[model samples]
Target: MRYRDENKVLAIREAAIDMVASDGLENFGINRLAKAAGVSPATIYIYYKDKEDLLTSISIEEGVKMTRATLKGFDPNMSFKEGLWVQWQNRAAFSLDNHKSAEFFEQLRNSTYKDKMLETINDEFRKNMGNFVENAIERGEIERMPLEVYWSVAFAPLYSLIRFHNEGKSLGGRKFKFSEKIMKETFDCVLKGLTK
Candidate 1:
């Protein structure tokens, strides 16, 4: 085999993300991935154990980035609303600027491998998020509920808007855009409903 090249691994990852996003997960295969990456199937084996391993790698790498981006400016001492606003902004910007990573994430989150990917996410990032949520509940800033519910309430809308904006789609003939006004309104509405 030729000397190992890190660029080949990165190309494989990029191709995997694009392929997974464009085609359903079930349709993805080593031959197609190799062709897309311009690398041989044997080379992929050198870098990854199998398709599952490569997919898991993508999940962990992108998951950490998205998690770190989501937690940018997160402060347990700050009001829950302030933290949420910061989260919204970070996530929106990350998704808009890194569409491939964002799409890879969205696809993975909705795939059968989601549970396994979640299990492998960075523990430090998970703990920080948990601490923020627990602190909010203890402070009586939000009602007691599963962390997933709280997150869905806080971010699902923002994700929808970002998706529309990325696709340049219009809602009733008006192009979708993310703005401070939209962010503030979303934060207010979602936070108010969660508050005690």
Candidate 2:
């Protein structure tokens, strides 16, 4: 039995993410991915069974990575403001540093694979996030609201800013650059709206 090459695997993964992000999933295929990764289609088969398997596997791996990055140093028991600040810092750092992976996930979330991907997300991530929201509501640190509303208010602005940063321009063709100051100011507004 031949052993799989880690370098090739990494190359395939990166190429797959870039392809999917740039060309959309409809245009992704093993042949195209093999060419992009400089590997043969047989090599991809060594690791993944088929297109669905490959896409799902990569999405699961990326989701775990994102979960870990988002949850670093976070605790459900912390005050809502403190916990959310940590989340903001971690998420902003991860999304900025891994913009392609972030974009891939954004696309995945809207695709037919979304349900399957969500089913595979880390259990700890779900638990901690759920507990954090519950604790916040119980402690009166944040208003009781639907999950959709909470996510929209808590994270939509951060994502919008990240999108602007990635594009290098914002509204009115203004040059855009990401800064901690901007993130903090945006977080403050989100925090105030979330809390009483």
Candidate 3:
């Protein structure tokens, strides 16, 4: 058996994310990733069974990290407005600070691996979000609505803004910059639309 090195694993994971985020999953390949990680193809096999295994493992790890970051200091029992505000702040910070990982997730979600990855999403994330929505409806802080409708209204705008920020351009080819004030203003509009 070959000895496994932690540094090699970290390098492989980081290079995989950077390559996936920049060149996209369609263009990604194991040989290319091995070169980028400064490890032999066989070395990658030491840590991952194959390319699919590598991608799935990295995606699952990143998903867990994202969930932890987004749920930090958040409480499902909080008022709808307060809870949502916390979520927005947490999500924005995580997305911006780890834009490459965020981009990798976006690509993964749209790829064939999405269904495979979805099966491994942190159970606590689903449970907490579910509880948060139920609590909000029961408290009369937000109207009762389908989960899809609620998610669309509550989080889609934030994601759109983040996309614009990542691209550094919005509609009409205008240069774009993201700011806390802009995020807060957008959140207010979403909050208004969601409230009872």
Q: Rank the candidates by lDDT, best first.
A: 2, 3, 1
Model 3: per-residue lDDT, tens digit, 1-196?
6777899999999999999998888878889999999999989998899889999999888888888999999999999999999999999999999999988987898898898678666789899999999998898888788889988999999999999999999999899999999999999999999997
Largest TM-score belongs to which candidate? Answer: 2
What pairs collide in candidate 1? none
Clashing pairs in 2: none
Model 1 misplaced regions, further than 4 Å: 146-149, 170-174
Q: Which residues of candidate 2, in runs, are more than 4 Å off? A: none
Please give the lDDT score for candidate 2: 0.92
The lDDT, on a scale of 0 to 1, for candidate 3 is 0.91
- Which TM-score value belongs to model 1? 0.84
- Per-prediction TM-score, please? 0.84, 0.96, 0.95
Model 3 TM-score (2 dp): 0.95
Worst ten-residue run, lDDT, model 3? Answer: 115-124
